[model samples]
Target: MICVGIDLAAEPAATAVARLDADGTTLRLRDLHLGADDDAIVAAAAGADGVGIDCAFGWPAAFVEFVSAHAAGRMPETAPTGKDGRRPLAYRRTDVEVQRRTGRWPLSVSTDRLGLTAMRCAVLLDRFARAGEHVDRAGSGRFVEVYPAASLRIWGLLEPRYKVDPDARAATLDRVLAAAAPIGTTASQRELMVRSADAFDALIAALATIAHRRGRTHPVPGHLGEIAAAEGWIALPDGGLAEVLRG
Candidate 1:
């Protein structure tokens, strides 16, 4: 069984496909390109099972619900209200940048948004729903899953060379390599390690790690179909769960 994970980063998305065979863990393929073209991505994920994507599945309605619900009562208000009354989700304590240039923000902000956070989850779910009819390759899967692929880096699952910061990545890698030792570091450094956000390739590497550790083989019947929506962890049809099987 092969589990594929994709680290979906904007700004020229990078895809790294990993495979764990009897020979051990191997990064089978890596591609850097624009991922908005769905057909290309679908074709790329030919004969694979399971995939995890690092992007908003759709608007995180749940997150919005939280903001509308407790944010007013819990979080302190910002500067004194001007002409208009205060608003919720306004001047949040969060550091979401107000883009002066392109007026665009990273998924970090969207991920924090209600209903928006699940956008990618919706994408994977949709793909899995159509896997049976669309995924025509023999032994290829027909299901999908959406995971916060970045969580793998947070969980200490990654290869060494891909680490951008040598000292820090290496140190974190060491912790990843050995779980026995007590974490020896300051709080701020630990925080950065926890939040190291390398989107696409990083996530793909993480999925490889998951499959290597806990994947089971299942014969995938050739099928093709698609299902898309805005929601949370759903077991998509055609075996599309939360792993990057292709593209």
Candidate 2:
């Protein structure tokens, strides 16, 4: 199986994509692209069994509803006045569940700068749909939302300051390599991961895609199914890297 991972940025210059080929036992890093544009990302994902994107697929459902109601000049009767009361508008159900399981909150796509990247993701999803690959934001189709940091935490490969510190990134890469013994990477590829946090995250996103494909990630709770489908769910790995790569 082939899995493609994208570390999407608000613009093409900072985006990164990684492709992995898994043969049921060993997985090889077939390609890695830095400074990827939308077309390049679409090409990288073409024909892949699963495409994992490290970006929110959609904003919080409540946020969307609120914005729509305000635009239509029909505001709700009650308004949330405080952060606590407005929490539902800022964070999705999946985001809340991820925090519950991992004790760390993923960025709020509804309120944070990450929303810009998610806008780009929205365009990409539309492009895929036009191309006949309709992606399910709830993660039932070829494309799925993935959080690299959350997956790293679940797999026990997370390193402190890895995103900003080179030494920490190198250490994190070493730990990931040790955990995923079946993963094959060239020396230059390893160096790329050490030098660029985006590249490192793209690789982890690919691994997380494998875990999702193999049913190793936590599923959306039955109660939150409708909300998750509308708000987009984050696929968090439930097992270690070794188990994820075993496929």
Candidate 3:
């Protein structure tokens, strides 16, 4: 099976993509692209059996309502997250659920600068939808949402500090690639990951795609599936990522 993974960023220069080849057992990194744009992303995923993108697909249900109310020039009686005053509508139940499961807090797509990235992804998802690609909801669609950082922690791999620490970046990249041993890599791909954290994250997202496609993913609580379908859900390995790591 062929899966495409995209590490989308607010700026196209920071974006990256990876293609994974999984024969149902062993996985291989077939290609990697850096500094991609919307067209580039679509071209890369043209024939993919599955696609995993690292970005928010939808807004919080409350944020949706809040936006509508704000547009109507009326005060929203309830806070975005259904609470009282001052809580931002940034965290979705899936985000909260991920924190409950892994203790790593994902960035707020609504409040944080991630909104730009999500906006881009929203356009891309629409393009995919127009092209007849279905988002794999809970490992059932052709596309799915992915979170590489959380996926790394769930896989028992070293979660690295790539943005701030130059010294830590190389080591962190090494650990991530090492943990993804199931994906047969070459000398060049290793060098690429060593040079670009974006590439590394894209690779991790690709691995998550393979994991999800294989039906080895964890789903959100049943009650939240509806909201998650609209807001997007991060795909984590069901039990452990050992199966994907094994040679």
TM-score top scorer: 2
**TM-score of predicted model 1?**
0.40
Tens digit of lDDT per residue, candidate 1, span 37-144? Answer: 345445545554444444434333334555566667763344325433332223221112212211333333333443332444345446756665432112123333
Task: Report every candidate's CA lDDT.
Answer: 0.36, 0.90, 0.78
Compute the lDDT for candidate 3.
Answer: 0.78
Tell me the deviation in Å of residue 28 in model 1. Answer: 7.8
lDDT of 3 by residue, 1-247 (tens): 8988899998889999999887755778889979899899989887898789988777777777778888999965544443443243677777877888798778888877799898888888888778887754444687888888888788777545765555566677666656555568888887777678788889878888878877778866788778888788888776556675442
In candidate 1, stretches whose alpha carbon ends up further than 4 angstroms from where it belongs are 19-40, 62-166, 171-230, 234-247
Candidate 2 accuracy as TM-score:
0.97
Clash pairs of candidate 3? 136-141, 136-143
Error of 2 at 79 (Å): 1.0
**Window of ten residues with lowest summed lDDT in model 1:** 93-102
User: How many clashing pairs does model 2 include?
Assistant: 0
lDDT of 3 at 185: 80
Better of 1 and 2 by TM-score: 2
The residue ranges of model 2 lying beyond 4 angstroms of the native Cα positions read: none
Candidate 1: give its CA RMSD in angstroms: 13.7
